[model samples]
Target chain A: MSEKTDIGRELDGALQKPKRQLAMVFDLNKCLGCHTCSISCKRQWTRDEGMDNMWWAVVNTQPGKGTPKNWEDMGGGWDEKGEPRPSKIPTRDEFGDAWKFNKEEVFHGGKGKVTYLKPVNTKGESPDWGPNWDEDEGGGEYPNSHFFYLPRICNHCTHPACLEACPRGAIYKRDQDGIVLINDKQCKGFRFCMEACPYKRIYYNHVQDVTQKCIFCFPRVEKGVAPSCARQCPGRLRFVGYLDDEDGPIHKLVHQWKVALPLHEEYGTQPNVYYVPPMSPPAVDSLGKVDPSKPRIPTAYLESLFGPRVKEVLAVLEAEKEKKAKGEASELMDTLIVYKWPEDIFPDFVQDPAEL
Target chain B: MLVKRIDVNGDVLGDPAASVWSTANGETVPLMPTPAAMQPTKYISTKWQNEVYGQTKSVSVKALRNADEIAFRLEWQDPTKNEQRIENTDFPDAVAMQFPLSEDASLFMGGEGTPVNLWYWRADHPARARSDVAHGIGTSRVMDDVSISAQAVHANGRWSVVMRRALSVTKEAASAIQIVPGQTVRTTFAVWEGGNLERAGIKAFSPAWLELEIEA
Candidate 1:
């Protein structure tokens, strides 16, 4: 199909170039696969009936099926020619509906022995799948098994497929910070955005009849406080800053050092969030000898996600690690280490939420 | 089709199976799926291209109007009553009627400079109907004023809906069809079966416009 169309052009025309774009970078090497970010995000935003299953910030084990199960196979966003790709709205069952435990029957109904604690879905049936159903079930056999935590959130793309797919024009990218948001009042609960977002981050709010997603913690950002997911992360792997700020870690990692790469660049949405490819331990032979030449996690697999730049990025990262290990100064290593908490990372958004 | 005029105190014709509706001839309009090729290109177009949707094939429609208001009774076969939007994927059954603002307006939702007024009713919002205006496909906007009222009932494998509206609405903030006591207007109908996840442009629509004349 032909790439360009008047409709696509018209949608692009409506967007104003933001003065500064807030961006995030997650170092996979440092992630502990903990659900702290997910929990913090849930406590801050998604704590309602329809939002029960929503995990705005999720850490899916790579090489395993991610949340919503095989989301990578679901087509969405723009194709190679910049044409919109078709995608389905993932059902609550596919997303793993929030399970309801039989607390009443187990605790108060005098059937504790028989009922115990059983989880049932909204339809009163045992749930078959959930958000983290494939947790830790990474690829390969036991000897060569490998996995990495892939922390995910809305990329808040420069050319958001969700924004373009909205026929009501309800989704908008803020001109100041390039934060994409769906106007709740204008939204008609159409859910076209959910289908168009390749990352499958947008969620449907059945109660309110509108689509909801990560707001990038705009309320906290406005008060100069880091987002809850980033602020409460125990691994301290997430870095946030304006993409244009030359002094910020985001720019240094994404543009200057070029160590961090956007996931699935082929999706063509221009996702703002980047990832520092994980460097894994060497593969083991049948004799239990470590093969230094073969990384446990295949480079071809990482290339499929982060594009051809994975090899170059990994090489630079390894060189930087070598320098740091030999007691030599490596600005890249120091930035990734993030020794000074919020100050060294989110310099522009340094104010604590409590103080604010 | 002729819309017979009823007196203000005449027997209520809200029920589709009411004896009064027997007097008005029912039109069996053949319905066809809104072509997937014509759906908006952004999302739904590709997802539903090959999927068989809008399985409903036809509907029986009867019309009645009083001196002050107009009413329509639409009946179609539906196995289930999908009244709840409680699930993220659940869609409520719905129906709509379309009228052109001008005589020469395009039948396909009207084009620019030719707008169409639409009265949309959904099973979830059973208490009232919403008023919307469309310049063309994908150009519909819900009007602020909701002057249309509707009630729907599903029983015995069918949905019976009764929708009523005033003859003329104040044009200050809303645009509506000015229903004269004795005037013929062109109209069309569309129905959505929520069980099939039908919404937006994924619907069954009347093949062609039907002419309606109000009794003087």
Candidate 2:
């Protein structure tokens, strides 16, 4: 273990190849609450059997049911003692189905009064829902309801919860570049990783009778190429680099600038992917009673995702906001390199093959 | 040559080069390695390679088990796009696959014609695939993995077709077809549509694509 195995060496050589890890960092503000990411990921990964039900990457419209519906509330990843947490498999309706036209109605009845339109199940069965059915769709009244997209995938963690949960040691974290992968040959399909994962990114391939997850594209990374999804993104929101690269954006965001924060940091998985939490609009007076002009990014919402430490971070952010408002630059985001559109900041991925 | 002599020593089938008519005489023809090679690749944990002979230009070889499948990564390229084929008047175009049976030897070549389904698999013997022919898809086929894709060839000329199979000797097979830029090479394969060594253990016979590797 001390000398790094062949795979470890392979991963080591891959890190400096300049092809990069190819990670997507969605800007919550610009997400538009669209299910484009979910649909794209599904087409690329789950177009085959067993993977029919899988959405390796999903976009959740927050303040609403997340994919695998209620994944956040499941409390997997790791317990206080670091044991794995079990998870519930999502139903077909949960992920949603591909939209279909009522061809039967259209074919037989010309100009039918009521056209039957529904999502078609790949298997010919009428699945109730699909991967993106509920995206941007919430159940609430006007004014109070709110939503934002939370695109998710395997964190490929520094201390992966799923990696530790596999009893057969079928799962491994490559020491060279730290990509957590399941050796399909050794995987028992026990799905311990599925349960151990806090983000519920691992999918049990029923057809293969084994467990599979995001690979971080080892072949491409080793060959100095990026993953398909990251490379093909139409929105340049993806950043491909190493966490250890001090000059890399990931390093600066997670450690140095400390702007990007992990979701539910209390889970203690030390996830590598971090989110720079989006700021929300101020609350409204639903009752027309209590004043609703309070600053958005509600303390409750922030605390729930980032823990109580969010309070201190928000205070600094607000003070900086005040100073900047009065003509003085805020120290909060000053040292931080904020990328912009057509560039890195709020960058859109160029996943559109047609465009290329 | 040791290559022709070796085939004569085994239960030699009909013309080995009949299906190879399109191949150049100088093209490096890959022969089956030692029987022990049925063992999986050390670098690639989920792959198995071997070579076999047969007749005709097309046939179907089926694995005798319920859990094995396959994909052929042919390493080839054509400057003039001459002999390289994209479709055969009757097949879908894409990667090809076959199911493998328990205790059967790994395959050296399986044509890209079977349809792929959720419960699809090859039922041929893993330890003795070469000794006998494989099985054919019956009407009773439940899990569908038998998919033939030679129809998707949009290119007009000789295109490099890697018969990538979703072969399942184990629980799940790694769908590793994403080419890694300059590190990966476009390979070639020879396809035979007919063969008949199918003796006692043999079950079926069909078109097969034998993978060929080239060194610079």
Q: In order, what are the TM-scores of chain A for the candidates?
A: 0.95, 0.74
For residues B73-118, what per-residue lDDT tens digits would candidate 1 score against the true structure?
8889999889888666789999988999877878778778888888
Q: Which candidate number has the best lDDT?
A: 1
Total clashing pairs for each candidate: 0, 93
Q: Looking at model 2, give its docking quality level.
A: incorrect
True contacts recovered per prediction: 0.61, 0.00
lDDT value, residue B140 of candidate 1: 77
Candidate 2 per-residue lDDT, tens place, A306-338, comes to 676666655555566678779887544542334
Query: Worst 10-residue stretch by lDDT in candidate 2 chain A?
Result: A1-10
How do the residues A41-103 of candidate 1 rate in per-residue lDDT, one tens digit apiece?
A: 999999986798899899998887787778898889998777789888888887788899989
